[model samples]
Target: MIVCHCNSISDRDILSAVEWMRAADPQTIITPGKVYHALGKRPECGGCLSLFIGTMEKSDSLGVPAVLQNLRPRRGRFAGK
Candidate 1:
């Protein structure tokens, strides 16, 4: 299924890109821009943004790296505010 008409990006393209990225770097955060770059294309119209995101969500490898997960600092943890 074609997700992005302007960029000629398909669901399969998105999935493949995601898997490749995950394999290359387990700690990498996959994004729409990266997918476009992987496919040698760029988004023209914003119409497909939602659908593009939907397709990306279907990938099993699409998740934050285990080591990098939940590294954010909690609120009010720093002193001298």
Candidate 2:
């Protein structure tokens, strides 16, 4: 299941990278670029983005951490504290 032909990245590779990253930092946002970096590779033509993203979405570890969820600015108006 090759995801990125240019970088020789496979589905398993992406999953492993995601798992590793999640294990390393539960709060880190998982992205294609970060997965590529984790696998020691980089995107070439950006053609595999759709499939790459698709594969990433399948991973259970790929989700925003609870601590980072619903973090919206409360009203704004903090003029120098």
Model 2 stretches with alpha carbons more than 4 Å out: 73-81
lDDT of 2 at 7: 81
User: In terms of TM-score, how similar is model 1 to the real structure?
Assistant: 0.86
- How many collisions per candidate? 0, 0
lDDT of each: 0.88, 0.90
lDDT of 1 by residue, 1-81 (tens): 988988778899999999999999888999999989888998897899999989999999998879987677656756333
Worst 10 residues of 2 by lDDT: 72-81
Highest TM-score scorer: 2
Candidate 2 on 1-81: residue-level lDDT in tens?
A: 988898888999999999999999999999889999999897899999999999999999998999997677555585332
Model 2 earns a TM-score of: 0.87
